[model samples]
Target: MIVRPRMHWLRMLFVWRGSVVPRILPRLGFFLALACLAVATGPHPFNLREGPLGLLGVALAIFLGFRNSTAYDRFWEARKLWGSLMIVSRSFMRQALTHPSPALSLEERREVTDLLRALAVSLNHQLRGTSVPLDALDSGVRERVVAAEHRPARVVLGLAEWVARLRHQGRLGEVLVTSFDDNLDRLSEVLGGCERIAGTPIPYVYSVMLHRTVYLYILLLPFALTGSLGWSTPLVSVFVAYTFIALDTVTAELEDPFGTEPNDLPLDAMTRAIERSVMDLAGEPLPPPLLPDKDFVLT
Candidate 1:
């Protein structure tokens, strides 16, 4: 989410801020020095320590590697889910535009387009935890759509109801009704997918264990390396801490793709894009694209 110039690796690192290490390392550094001091001033500072130290180092390496991989997977999965939403939303708009509805009145056609626009805005507000005011639309339409707790679903179901009404009134053929129904099903699937990602979370136990292990590893690292690395323990500790912290931060940001975080998928922009596309299909003037202000996009 912290966008930098393609060549600016150092800036990217700084922007990430090494979520875990910067927070835990100072305390660990103090404890590590205390441990080293205890051994250095003790009579048997060089007692058989190589075996445990070597084993711990290997274990920490493996654990950090696995944690980073898991975090990356979560991040990528969230991206793919949002990508799916984009595709499905576009397809729904296309179907609405292409399916012939010759018997629709001018007012009815306008209402359908407005409903789609409202759906996009409602979904954006729902995902971002923003309020969608009833005053945003005409009084009758606003009351009908805003009555439901799930605004997006209400908008979608309203579309389905409209299609059904048209069919019953002989305004649309059965085939056209079925086609719209298919599009509605796809929309529902997309809504369910987003809800799944939002509601589910990485296990708390995994997070707690990872935190404890990283802290313990950093604490023990200085003692393990002090004899060989000497006064350079702090420097090495910082590097190791950064590795774990960066992974943890990336994971936390990616876990909720719908959030307003700088790194999160730009759901607001996506919703607007959907609105623009739908409006364009309906022969309305397109809204301007949402542009990123600086290096970082909304996502």
Candidate 2:
């Protein structure tokens, strides 16, 4: 996501591109209009007392906090899994380059490296529900992996089979094969962890409940405060509404970290990093890192 440099507190307050303000502005405007109406009507027939509303706001904050925590947990765990994926990939590539006996030919070495590269790209696409980029795969590797149902798993299998072939040929000893297998297993775990996060989300009922309560609270807030706050009702109510609604919007974005949202994880950039790391180990000229956009969003 957003990768902007730190700004002064006052400048931070006015930062627009990465903030949730744009998404919730309409909702805040609606609250402002509703508050003005409550003031104009004098809270005549329906004055919601602040006592109950104050209690409700406190409870709402707690729930929002819980949900935000849960969403951030998912986002952080996904990032960690990708981190592990990168580490394991580098280790695997190092082994492929150094361990095999009768040393692998240029073609064989490229095959191994391409599979490593494809694993990251395929996993990135799989998580985001997008197609694998053709340019990322060699023609030969692409032919084999493209037909598979799970491209990442298929790429991993290719790696495993290569290791098996080495063992059968007496090129790789049992101990070396075991080391390769351990790293391969770690790669599989990374895949499984990413899948679990992508497949299972925070329960929808909680989201719906909080969404309704936040809006309804903002709706009734003006009526609750208009009697006392009078002319200041619109300003105060809209400001309050911004906090709850902005948190709600941000949690929604963070909950799906694989998404293309400005706040979501930068899967493309991460995949590129994995590629560069592997290429560097292979002694190839490394590709440039993916730069963030003008808005400082990486993907």
- Find the candidate with the highest lDDT and give its number: 2
* Residue-wise C-alpha lDDT for candidate 1, range 1-299, written one tens digit per residue: 44434647676555533234555566646765655574465443555354686687687667757766765676677566656656665665666656645644567756777777777778767877888854645465677777879988998888888788777777677777787888788778767776776777777787788778777766666666666666665577656666666566666767766776667777667767777776776677787887665755664
What lDDT score is found at residue 218 in candidate 1?
A: 61
lDDT of 2 at 99: 90
Indicate the worst ten consecutive residues by lDDT in candidate 1: 15-24
Clash totals in order: 0, 0
Which one wins on TM-score? 2
Cα error, candidate 1, residue 124 (Å)? 3.1
lDDT values of the candidates?
0.68, 0.92
Clashes of 2: 0
- Candidate 1: where is the Cα deviation over 4 Å? 2-5, 8-54, 57-61, 64-71, 103-105, 133-141, 295-299
RMSD of 1: 3.7
The residue ranges of model 2 lying beyond 4 angstroms of the native Cα positions read none
